[model samples]
Target: MEYDFTLKYQLAADDCDLDQIVERLAEAGCDDATIGVGQPGRVALVFAREGATALQALLSALEDVKQAVPSARLVEAAPDFVGLTDVADVAGVSRQNMRKLMLSHAAEFPIPVHEGNPSVWHLSDVLTWLNTRGGYDIKPDVLEIARSAKQVNLAKEARELEPRINQQLEYLLA
Candidate 1:
């Protein structure tokens, strides 16, 4: 299977030389990715990799990036975090239509990850909801890749949490 996904990173101050980073990435098994270094301290790699599963492909890319840029911090793994507009684009529907669906099915709609000005959600959650309703033409691989990206982002964030706080939150949230 070929999984399509993106991995974005925040480069360490010492690791911000774009040319060196690009050369290193190419040598580190990331020749399959389209590298983006527009931002001064950031890099985004859009990859189409082959593996048995979405997770395997994504994880391998993650590992390759880490090896190539040891000082860089993983900022996000995407197609995971998005707004209604993003979802609408992916679903081939107008933004207004997608908003209407969310409003009409507010109770059943998947919860947003952040609820403010422009709210955001996990793409897989919205896709799963649409899939259940039987009208969207979502690709299975897209859903799998989105899910895998979400997992990767969560795991990276999890590593930053204090174990004690995690335990307390786990118990309280549960």
Candidate 2:
């Protein structure tokens, strides 16, 4: 099975140059990796690899990124998925409100791409809706910044919650 993983790194808020990191990673044979504008002061690295090769590829990419930006520290790593709270945070609303909005505007809200205990949506789809919702009138540049912030917050929250969620799942399964 092909397992995909996203790794979040703590980047220095002042001197983090993502473009340089990308160039370095590319030179290191991790050309497929991407640096996403995460949170107000962080960046995220995403990798997709298959089987036994996955670990080595991930480690290689991590090493490359760290070399490029010495301040980089692995924050969290996980399989791809975005949670409801992430959507809510991106939308600048409470989770309860987001839930209500999704329910009432079911036709307009993007469907969850990953259906699990928390039901997650694709970041792109949710960002699209957040940027272009009928009455909100959010500008593109503003939305871009907002999207980055949301991504950062979402990644952090997901990392924080992963263990707790796994424990709950284990309890339920048992």
lDDT tens per residue, model 2, 110-158: 8886676889776556667866765554444334433443454455565
TM-score, structure 2 vs. true: 0.40
Record all residue pairs in model 1 with backbone atoms less than 3 Å apart, i.e. clashing.
Answer: none
Reference-based lDDT, residue 157, model 2: 62
Indicate which candidate wins on lDDT.
Answer: 1
Mark the regions of model 1 whose C-alpha exceeds 4 Å error after superposition. Answer: none
Model 2 CA deviation exceeding 4 Å by range: 50-53, 80-174
User: Quick one: how many clashes does candidate 2 have?
Assistant: 1
Write down the TM-score for model 1. Answer: 0.97
Q: Global lDDT of each model?
A: 0.94, 0.62
Per-residue lDDT tens digits for candidate 1, residues 1-174, read 998899999999998679999999999999999999998899999999998999999999999999999998999998899999999998889999999999999999999999997999999999999999988888999999999999988898888999998999889999
